[model samples]
Structure formats: C-alpha cells, structure tokens
Target: MTPPEPLRDVIARHGLQASKALGQNFILDRQLLARIAAIPGEIAGDTIYEVGPGPGGLTRALLDRGARVVAVERDPRFLPALAELGAEYPGMLEVIHADAMRIDEPALAGRGARVVSNLPYNVGTALLLRWLTADWPPWWQSLTLMFQKEVADRIVAPPGGGKFGRLSVLAQWRSHPSVAMQLSRSAFVPPPKVASSVVHIVPGNAPKDVAARSIEQVTEAAFGQRRKMLRSSLKSVPAALAALEPLGIDPQRRAETLAVADFVALARELG
Candidate 1:
C-alpha cells in the first residue's frame, strides 16, 4: 500500500474515489481530524470508535494523537489501505469489517469508549440516534461527530428555532450538544455540494424526574407533528398528555414550546 500524501494526491495515487452510495467524502484536513480526537479529552487510554474510516485518513490522525481507535469499515475495497494503517500503528488500531449499523457497539466499547468519526453521510443521523437513545447515559462517554450542515443545525437548535425538531429534542435531552466546527466543501477530496459541521456531545445522567426512553417516545410523537399545537398534534398521544395532567401541561402548547423537563414529564405521564 502506498503511504498517504497531501489529501488530494493520496486520492489520485491510489485511484481512490468517493462512493456516493456509501456517502464517502475524504477529508484532507489533518488539523480537523486531530481536533475531533482531542475534543473528547486526550486520546491516550481512551477507546475511540470511528465508523467508515475510508482509506484510514482520519484513522492515521487518531492514532498519531495517541487514541486507541476501533475503526469499523464497511468497504472492503479500503481494507488493504487500512491494513497498512494497522501495520503502522500496530496495537493501536483495530479494524473491523462490518456495517456500523449492525454492529454491537456497547459490547465493543465496553466502558469509557467514545464515538468519534467523520461519519458516513447516508447513515450519520441513524447512528447518532442509536447512541443518543441508549438506555444508560455514557454508553459512549461523548460524541464528536460530523453531519451535513442541516443536521448540525438541528443538533444544536435552541427552543423556538425553526431548525429545532426531533433531533434537537433527543440530542439535547441527554447530552450537552454544541457545534464545534464548521467545514467547507473544499475540505473533502470529492467536495460535497453542501457544507458540513462537526457536533460534539457529552452525555450526562438525566435528571431523576424522568426516564430516558420515555422522554424519547414523547418527543417522537410530539415533534412528529411539530408544526401543530400540542393539543392538536399530541392528540395522537393521549397517554402522554394524560401523564402530564398532574404537571398541568397546557395541551395546546406545541412540542417546540415544551422543554426537555416537560417532555420527560409527558413521557412519564404516558408511561
């Protein structure tokens, strides 16, 4: 395998191509990858999970920064190139051949592992949902992830914002989410049409007032008809509103108007 080069040259040398089907876009920015690795504390002694690390560009950066990276790559075509990375890092890189969607991450990560990846555009939101919706907090201690700019906006959306919706509700319900960096199309080898942004989330224990899964269900139903008033929109979730009866929730309020605590109360009421 050829040694990596300036991000663009590396792509040209190996006949490397981005697969639209896989939602692959190669980042040429070394500093950005390093920044991601650094976000969840020092890399050393930390288990870092990177999904779809095509060509191991980010893998190299993670390893160089001293993090133990468990890289799950779905594309076998990139295996040879990734094998070279494993060779270089030796015990530091563990490359798995599996669809990230199907893999059992909790078992793989054990404890103290963090999910940090550039993320495959096609499956990014789905994967984020899985991590955020896990039963216990700290399933992955934190998430340093990339998403299309639109998704990023949703992740960091504040109450009453147009971009705020289900993603904002779910993500903010457990983790303190923020946009760490904004990336341009030119950063990737095959420039994507839209800009991208990196989101960093550090999950904490949900307040004792609510259960995690319950809030999830309530938010799903409430935001499902996000534009409608809660009284009208949440009518489908009689159980949720009934649960909130003691809390004196105004049935007419919409999902966006409700805070995370309110959703938790509604979720509990529904349960």
Candidate 2:
C-alpha cells in the first residue's frame, strides 16, 4: 500500500511545520524514500536505523520494503502518528522518542542492521562523524543519509579541495562515501533554502596502520584554526611536532592539503 499523504496535509493544517533547529525536512516522495532505504548494500532482510521519521513518512517507506525500522524521533508532536504506524506495521517499526545525537547508535543497530535516513540538515554532520568512526566496523555496515549539498561535498572531498577539512578527514578515513542522489528544493512540502543529496557510505576495515583515534586528533587540530599551517595550527599540543614528524607530513602544509591517509598517519604519530 502507498503510504498516507493525507497526514502531511493534516500536519500542515495543525501548523506543525518543519523545525529549522532540528534540521527536519520531511520527504514526501515515495521513490526517493525507497532509494534512501536501498543505500545500505542489500537492505533486504536487514534491519534499519532511521533517525527522525517525522509523521512516519520514511518509516512507512522502510516498512514497505520488508526492512524492520528502529526510528528515533525527538519531537513528541509526531508520536501519536508514529504510534498509529507501529500498529500498521506490527513487529517492524520500533519508535524511540529521543534526540538522535545523544542516543547511543551502535547500541541501537543490534545484530545485522544498517543506518538509513533523510538526515536532518542541522545535525547531519555530527551524526555522520559519530557513525563513521565507530569502534567496530560491521556495527551498522552502511549509512544512507541526506545532508545539505555542501555537507555532501565535504564528506566526499579529496585532498587539496576546499571541502576538505576535519569532516573530510574523518569520513574518508573510515568509509567509502559517495553521493547517491540529489533532490531539488521543490521536493519537500515546504522547501528548504538549500539543495540536498543522499550520501551512501560503506564502512569497511580501515587501511593498514590507520588508527581512528589519531586521525580524529590530527584532523581536529588541523581544521581547528583552518587558516594556519599544521605546525601553527597544532600549537595547542606540545608534542604536536612528534606526532607530525614520522608521517613525513610537512609542518607548513595546511590541513586541507593533506589526504585522508596522511591525516591517519599523522594521527597515529600523535601518540
């Protein structure tokens, strides 16, 4: 059965507009929802972790695809609607009312599960960072998420690019990421200011000698100032030189100039 569109009209009638602070942009297109769900390689029979299933739009889409959805919604305003969805998809939609950022995600994706969502533009970067550098690799397996086009560029950026920053380092260090789909502003019920795209990331084992922690530390320092070179930027840490020494990365080089692997190496040397 096609999911309910009438609920959206009802939601708007009640003045339940998308919250900019929460980065809530509801997806009304059925085909788009299906595409987002399909991001985690072979989602069939795989459990899905969905953040912010506002009015159960994406929730219904995931359920229709036979994937069990663990939706974490923060807004109580939509709980009643979600509850109704739970009834419709028995033993499938597990709705939790909480802030997705604060909630422990790996704990949520028990067994063979995947991260799938039209991510809130506001918290998208934070959530992506948390999941990408997770301690365990097969924890969620893959992430299919939406972000502002700019954020998407940062995630998939390479060395010496403007989008390259701590985010670029962190995301590329752990996963192979790519933009799967782009949606225009017109796609939403009440359009947002910026365009958005779905980013699909497959988290696999890191390359040899890349400690996730070190990459994090180095990237933080490098992108902290963002204007200064590595040597100048890392002045906060007394042992910064020791960390950057072994990697053969120049102290004069800017953070954005370094590739993901270089950042990983520098991070390891930090200790």
Candidate 3:
C-alpha cells in the first residue's frame, strides 16, 4: 500500500490555509496530535467526535489510534482534503460538512461517544457551555477540548481567584475538569496570538434535586455583578438573595469568593 501523504504535503497539494474568520489554526505535528488524541485515554475502539478538523491534522491522529471519528467541518474549502482522508481511513472516518453549532451532536454521535476537538476559538466557550448544560449525565463519555489558555484557566480555576466565575462553577459543580496539556503558539500552521491548553473533563456527582438552569440563573446574577457583595448582586434574583440568609451564607461575600458547592447550594435553595 502507498504511504499516506504528509499533512504539510496535503495542505500544499490542496492550497489550504487557515482562515482567520473561521478561527482556524491547523496543528500539523503528528506527535502533538497523538498526545491530544490520548487525552481522553484508551480510545482504540471508541467513537470520537471532532470539530473544525482543518486539513484533517488531528483527525489523522485519531484514526491512526484506531478511533472511529465523526468530524464536523463547516468550511467547504477543506472538504476535499477531508474526503481524501476519509477514503484513506475507509470505514473509520465519517466527515460531516455542517455548522457544528446547528447540528444535533448527541443524536449524531450517539450516547457515550467521547468528544475530542481542537475547537474553533470563536465558538469555544459557547460550545463548552452547551455541552456542560445538556441533559444530566451528558451524552458524551468525556470532553477533551482545546481552548485559549485564558479560557482554559477559567474552566479549572478555583474559588477566590479572579479567573473563577460562572464557567468555573458550571464546569466543576458536576464534573472533574483539568488542564491536560499546554501548547505554545508556534504549534499551529499559522500561529494564533495566544497560547492554547487542552482541558479534559469527565462527569462527576452532580447535586440531586438541583436544576442546571437554576445554577445558571444564580451564577448569572452573581457574576453579572461580581464586584458587588452577594447581597447586592443577587438582589436581581430575589430567590437567590433570600436563600443566602437562610442557607447561612454571608450576604456580604462577593461572587468570586463563593465555591462551586456554594453555587449549587444557592441553586438548590432557589428550587
């Protein structure tokens, strides 16, 4: 069998360049891609869901690891290259050309599929929130996603830190999230301005009887005015404010000072 073309050669052959508008930054290093594919752990036979697979760089790594990948790509320009990759991998790769934001991921990827992606920067946070807030015991078995270093810090930040806020609370309240690896800006074909980090998250015990929306509402109210005391910030959410005193939480505390459990408590109280 003929050896597959190198990623750089593929890009050159396809006249492909990362699109700034699409938040595309291609990672061509096979070793780095392999490391990323390994973040979710032991996926030899597991199905993997990927997004924005520009030039199929990471897709190749996942396929090489014996993973069956369902890759979503919105840009038509890269479809031909991806089609070639799909052919190379034969039955292992399924390339879907659609906007990932509009597609029904759970239905397409099915239950217990692992989500691993070098997410597009423009929609990274919004996509993370979507997955985090999906129906309890989310469809995906795990999430190994790449994000700007700043956003990664927010996801794993602890209470009392400036980075800790709604994202931190939501991520931690029901899951274990940690920075799996850090990548320098130079790792990309056209380097992004900021560094990047990969975050691996698996579901943890979520508080029973507390609705995810309630947590979202409470955090929205609190962090919307993070500089103000909880008593002042949560005033917009009367139930949240009233619950604070009853729950023995200091009304004088600022949002950033509260822990994930505190937010869950507030959400439970709001119920």
Candidate 4:
C-alpha cells in the first residue's frame, strides 16, 4: 500500500493558505484533527458531511476512520489539494466546492449521515441553528461541530446562567449537546482571535406536539428583552402573555429564569 501524502506537503504543493474573509483558520495539527474526528464515535461506514474542509486536515481523519466523507469547501485555492485527497481515498471522499449556507445539507446527505465540521467562524452559529430547528428528527444522525468557546458555552449551558438565553433554550429543547473538546488558538495555522471548542450533539425527542419554530419564536421574544420581565418582553408575540397564566408561569419572571421545559410549554401554548 502506498503511504498517504502528508497534509503539509499537500498544502505546500497547492500553495494553500487560510482566508480571513471566509473565516478560515486551517487546523494543521494532526492530533487535534484526530481528536475532533473521534467525537462522532463509531462512524465506520457512515457518511459524514464536512463544511469548510480547507486543505483536508479533519477530512483526512474522517476518511481514515472508515467513514465516507462529503466535504464542502468554498475556497478555490484548496480544491486541488482536497481533490488530491479524494484520489488518495478513492470513493471514500467527495469534495464539493460551494458555500455551505446555501446548500440543502439534508438533501445532499440523504438519511443516516452525520454532520462533522470545523466550521468557519462567520457562519458557525447560523449553521448550528439551522440544523437544530430542521424538521425532526433531523436528517443527520448527529452533529459534531467546532465553534467559538463562547458560542459553545451557550449551546451546552443549562438554565439560569447569563449564557442561557435563546440559543441555550433552542439547542437543549431539541437535542442533547455537550462540549466534547476545547481547542486552543495555537491549534490552527493562523490562530483565531477567540478560543474554540467542539460540540457533540445528538437529536433528542422534541416536546410532544410542540413545533421547533414556535420554540424559536417564543425564545426570541422572551430573550429579545432579556432584562425585562416576560410580560414586557413577550408582549410583541400575540397570545404569549395569555398563555403564561394557563401554564402557571410567572409573568414577572425574566427569560433567564425559565427552564427548558417552561420554554417548551410556552411554545406549545403559542401554537
């Protein structure tokens, strides 16, 4: 068997560098890439959808672990390098040169695939929210994603903390999420300004009869004015105030004080 080409050689050969405009900070550390890859455990034979696989660092790790990868990369500079990886891995890798935000991941991924990416900083939160609120159970089996530590904190944060707000409510309501690993700034070729963490998320049963969009609206209204009482903050959302009384929630309470279950109940009543 021929040895696989080293990532450094591949990047040097292709003259690839991270693009600040695209929020790209390529992870060159092989051990760190391996660690991120291991978060979605038991992925053998599973299809993995990777976003922004610049120079194929983590993409290589995913393929080495007996998984087929569909990697979406927008940077043209890295395409040849990734194409080389595709050739090395043969049918195990498919490289798509397109923006991740516009693509229909579910349709592209089919069913039973897992989403694993070292997401670009600019679109990390938007992409996560898209996946979370997607039709349940989400088409993807699980999400192993990288994000700024602050954003990751919000996703896995429990109720009552300052970090617990709209995102905290929405993510916990529909999925089980935890910070799987923390990567320091030094891990990347051009370190990001903020620290990063990997979040491992698995789909969970949404509240019975409650729609995800309703939860999004309820949380948006409730946290839009985080400092105000629910009565004041939620006034813009019709029936939100009216639903509070029947659910036995205190209108005097602020958004931060409400539990995940409280938000679910509010969403159900709003619907």
Task: Find the candidate with the highest lDDT and give its number.
Answer: 3
- Model 2 has an lDDT value of 0.78
**Candidate 3's residue-wise lDDT over 87-136, tens digit each?**
88889999899999999998889899999999999989999999999898
TM-scores, in order shown?
0.93, 0.90, 0.98, 0.97
Residue-level error in angstroms, candidate 1, position 24: 0.9
RMSD of 4: 1.2
Point out where model 3 deviates above 4 Å: 1-3
Q: What C-alpha lDDT do the candidate models reach, one value each? A: 0.82, 0.78, 0.93, 0.89
Clashes of 1: 1
Question: What's the true lDDT of residue 254 in model 2?
Answer: 88
Candidate 4: pairs in clash: none
* lDDT for 185 (candidate 4): 93
- Backbone clash pairs for candidate 1 read 243-269
Better of 3 and 4 by lDDT: 3
Worst 10 residues of 2 by lDDT: 1-10
Clashes of each: 1, 1, 0, 0
The regions of model 1 sitting more than 4 angstroms off are: 1-4, 243-245
lDDT per residue (tens digit) for residues 77-143 in model 2: 8888888789987888888999998987767769557888877777888888777777756577678
Candidate 4 Cα errors over 4 Å, as ranges: 1-3
